[model samples]
Target: MGMAVVTLKKGEGRLLKSGGMWIFDNEIDTVMGNFENGDIVLVHDFDGYPMGRGFINTNSKITVRLMTRDENVDINEELLEKRVRDAWEYRKKVVDTGCCRLIFAEADFLPGIVVDKFSDVLVVQSLALGIDRFKETIVKLLRKVLAEDGITIRGVYERSDVKVRKQEGMEMVKGFIGPEFPTLVQIEENGVKYEVDVKDGQKTGFFLDQKYNRLAIQKLCKNAKVLDCFTHTGSFALNAGIAGAASVTGVDASQLAVDQATANATLNGLSDNVKFICEDVFELLPELEEKGEKFDVVILDPPAFTKSRNSIKNAVKGYREINLRAMKLVKDGGFLATCSCSHFMDYELFTKTIGQAAKNVHKRLRQVEYRTQAPDHPILWAADESYYLKFYIFQVCNDR
Candidate 1:
């Protein structure tokens, strides 16, 4: 049989034309020829102009994810190898390769799959059906590509156990892709060591995106009283402790996370200065405020408050409340580092909310620096979803 062809509706494909990878179901006028879901298909404009090639999955609203704009290039093992090599090469140039995001799905032009390297272990998350079929191939290719640099991959694990996989018509599953090794992998970033649990830890076992953001706070922490809210595994708190913070208090709602974070602190021999407390930040912040507690440096690294647009209003409220409280907690002329990981909470909105919070709390913020996710998670311009994290550092001052 000939290749299946997907024709875009008139005036559709705007996002695709601008270099995005997704083609929504509503954008496609029709599909001609025969092919199964997850099969490679040819894409065409409304007037039958050849557009590109992509994998189509009717199971997803994102019907097609373009692999290439060139209609002539064949999608084969050679192309896959090239994609893997290019991603690895880019990381080698831009960020530390020891433990970083190797492939960031659409940002890397691979679409629908993310691979994180923790030390020698590789954790893969395949979120789309079309990419699910090629996960093993990509992993093998990545292993081969890394071996070229004399880097041996000890093990590979799958962490595709996300609810979004159900939307893609795939069962959520995770397990060792190859011979099982120890799940807890040790990695060092900016002189801070972490034991990443690739098998059961959150989101491929760690948040590698904040690799540099955590480093940015080091200088401001020396001999400073530091408070790290939502300190999962004590990444930021430990960094502060390492930077010679006078004292560090890290809080998280999860006992598991607090235990892990406490273990990490002990692992670094920072248990004396850096401590983990199991408490809801929302509750603890107010309680600490009531007791007139203050810190020279306050870090707010909460999880995504809003995952989708529908709940953005509530997310804003959550962000504003925590930021206001954090500002109150920071001593005069001290630093506050706040961030939002929700893509729905765009930069403009997040900044506006922070400003509002500062005004309400009678605090003045002197902008220090603005940062995003580490370069390893490159933000592809047209793919807005690739750019989720927004971090800001500011010196909080009481109004004169």
Candidate 2:
């Protein structure tokens, strides 16, 4: 195969030298030759020496996502297979639970792709132009890796509804890739059981990234009155109930999510202590406060408020608004669990937003735990930008 080398201008190689995987279009000085999207090309420095091997996409803002910095190595099926196998090996060694993020995007050195393994099924999402173009190869690699491990995967479902895909000029597509669709599957994590819908529900049927956070809240739930706002499928509320909360109330704008949450609660035989409301959280919180409702714990895990840089300011307001309301509702000293999946909002800004909210409510907070997407949604060290999920568990305090 003919080789195409991409050269970077002075100082543009800093991110690469620092082990970062992405190279934006503006960072490159020249592309020696034309290469198809997802084509692995040799990267050269300003001095024209081979620097690395990476996937290319001229049409993307991110022109390159490097797979390796080793000059002697060639990027091929063998290398790809090795990466997948290595990811599996790491998961096996650390994550004993069947429910976990199986393949993280850049952390696995495969940018723009995510794979979540639940029971016997695998849910994959491709958000980059290069990865979307090479999805067939990725699918084949997944199957081959599972087969080699003597594991028969029941299905491979696609959940590529991410907004990033649109920027890559790809439309949202989802469904079963195998012979049959899985309407529901039972998964156990941290000794808690869950039934996830991989076909038509949230990311691969469940937010497996919150596995640990859910379990953490479980330990604090005994005899506590819990309120789970934006309670999609009631992962937090149900976990609270099952973990021995005196009672749990869940609220969401989606009746579908409410229905599913109710069904999940019943599945675990915790319906007696759990209640669901299909109401917009923005309006419901104040009503609950007026009704003299107080909870020992409250969870606020909303969808991404900022999809791009343009929406960040408004998104911060949204985040701060929800947090301020939730913090007020929690009894003094009660736990407040809040999260943001917006990549455009960094942790510092997110915390600052929370701080502003706390000030607005005239309340103080003590952060107890800081969390991110689950281990399977690996944050590649060089690619902190891809690790967008953030969570903070705090204890509400009285104003001085």
Candidate 3:
């Protein structure tokens, strides 16, 4: 296929030059050029200097998500194989253990695509229109790279159940790409064992990024009563239980998550200490307060509230509301581990929102620790925005 030439308007080339992956629609001088969706476009400065080669989609607000900024790059099947192999090599070197986040979108120089490898199998998610068009190439490269390394790919599943897939004009696809389905695979994270459900569970079956954070909580849960809110799959609750928490209450809105959490607790032999409850967290927080129940350690990790810039205001309100009630439910001198996965909400703003929420509840707050995604999920130094996960470990001060 021939590549389309796309020259950016004045200053539009700066982002690409500085290693930014996305090119917004308004930044393009497209009056002189028109490219169909999924077309490979060679981007250039207005002065005719080449910027990069990337897939273009006029339908999306993100006009271009650069796959490669190299002027000589083609981004075809062979190149895709190299990218996949290179990503795997980096992960293998960095992660001595078998379990880690294998591919992080822009951080690995491949925009709009994320692939997570749990042992011999792989789970891939296409998040952008441009990447969706190249899904075949990605799959081929994954198979080739695995074969070349003498590793048998037990299965390759497509879990594009994320909302972003619909926005990209692609229906959610979930199925095994390879010949076989993988049974639940065991992976150890910071001494805790987890079974990942790549074909069925949320986000490639596990939140590998929170692997370390869960371990951090284990230290404080000795004989403690822990409340794990929005605990999908019971990672925190199970950790607390395994760490000798007197009791762990795990709450989630999704019945499936509750069931999964229960099963996970049983798998880890922590069902005796952990209890799973399926309920709306927004309502349950208040109900816990009404029941005069307080926790020694509280964990609140909700799904992203703000997907776009327009939803920032409402998202902030949601964050503050949850944090406020969460703080109240934590006994004085206890820890409150709050997290925001929303990329639109920066770390500073997220913490500030939680602080404001604590003040509203008349609780004295002391920042204990700052946390982020696991090491396998490396963030590109050039792309700070890709560092979307932010966590805060705070203590409810009693001195007032």
Candidate 4:
């Protein structure tokens, strides 16, 4: 039998019409077939014009994740292999294939699946039951696709232990997808070496999205004293050290992260200049201010303050507080690099929050540059979720 059919309400699906990939459950008018959660289904409008084909799940708010608009396209091994190959080829042309986001879920047209390649290792996170069915196939296809380019993936690991799985009514799972080897993988990026812990580290063991942003801030650190707040695994501080900074202090609340960051500094032979401190940045920044401490460069790469829309107000407060304190800590005429990783804090809201902080502190923010995630994490227009990261560099000066 052919795939089941789905119909959307009138005036709904404006997002899909605008090139987005998701269909909200509220937009669905009726489901006209025996399709359970995670089953491939055909979608159509109220008038019965075909919209697309996608995976349907009653368990998730995103009822349908459209796979392709072409009705003739079949959902099979051939299509899966093509998606993997197309993603790889796009990455090779735009990003360094040695380390990058191989598949960015909806951005790469493979909804609910994320694959990151770190050297010879691939880490995958499949969210929905429908998408999870194809996780292994995607990995095998990816391996074969890379083999054509003379690259061999040493191992594949699954990082599906996140809570999003529960929303989809799936079990939390994390383990090796194939033959097990050392989970500790090493890779170099932006002239710095990192020992990525694929088994237990945060977000696929490393934040590949900030690859170039780290390199952009390094230019302001030559012979300077730098402070990197929320320095997960010490990427920013290590970059400052590699850029010839006289000294670097990286602070994180997680002791495990600080310990691993210290190890990373040693691995890169940068222990002499780069150091890690296990402390809450909020408390430490105030203490530094009380002691009249300042730095030539200050970086704030804090985690997403709010993961959901309800917490956006508090998230703005947090971002403003950190940015205000960080601006005060920068030496006169020096530099500050700051960013928010949450899409709930949209670009306009983020920039406005920063401006309010600058006003309250009575500082002049000379905008150096505004940047986003590297090309590997491509932001699809109209798909607001694809565009999350917002980065900025500024020179701080007293309002004379």
Model 2, residue 143: displacement in angstroms?
3.7
How many residue pairs in model 3 have overlapping backbones?
0
Residue 385 Cα positional deviation in candidate 2, in Å, after optimal superposition: 2.2
Query: Per-residue lDDT of 1-400 in model 2, one digit per residue for the tens?
Result: 5767899997787777888888888989988876777787889988887788888877678888887888678766787788888888888876653777767878887778888888888888988876676676777787788788787788788889776676666788887666776568887666556678887887667888787788778877899999998989888988898889999999999998999889888888988999999999999888888898888999998998887899888999899999999988989899899999888889899999999999999889998999987776777676777678899999998796
Question: What global local distance difference test value does model 3 have?
Answer: 0.82
Off by over 4 Å in 2: 147-150
lDDT of each: 0.95, 0.83, 0.82, 0.94
Q: Which parts of model 1 are misplaced by more than 4 Å?
A: none
TM-score ranking, best first: 1, 4, 2, 3
Across 1-400, the per-residue lDDT of candidate 3 in tens digits comes to: 5567777888775666676787888888753456678777888777888777888877777778788878697777777777778888887777643667667888887788888777777788888877777776787777677677787767778888887676667677778775767657766666556677787888888887887888888888999999999999888888888899999999999998898888888878888889999999999999989999889999999999998889999999999999999998999999999999888998888988987998798899888899998777887765767788998888897645
lDDT of 1 at 33: 97
lDDT of 1 at 204: 95
TM-score, structure 2 vs. true:
0.94
Clashes of each: 0, 0, 0, 0
**Per-residue lDDT over 1-400 for candidate 1, one digit per residue giving the tens place of the 0 to 100 score:** 8899999999999999998999999999999999999999999999999999999999999999999898999988899899999999999999999999999999988999999999999999999988888899999999899999999999999999999999889999999998989999999999999898998888899999999999999999999999999999899999999999999999999999999999999889999999999999999999999999999999999999998899999999999999999999999999999999999999999999999999999999999999999999999999999999999999999998
Q: Candidate 3: misplaced stretches above 4 Å?
A: 31-36, 143-150, 182-187, 382-384
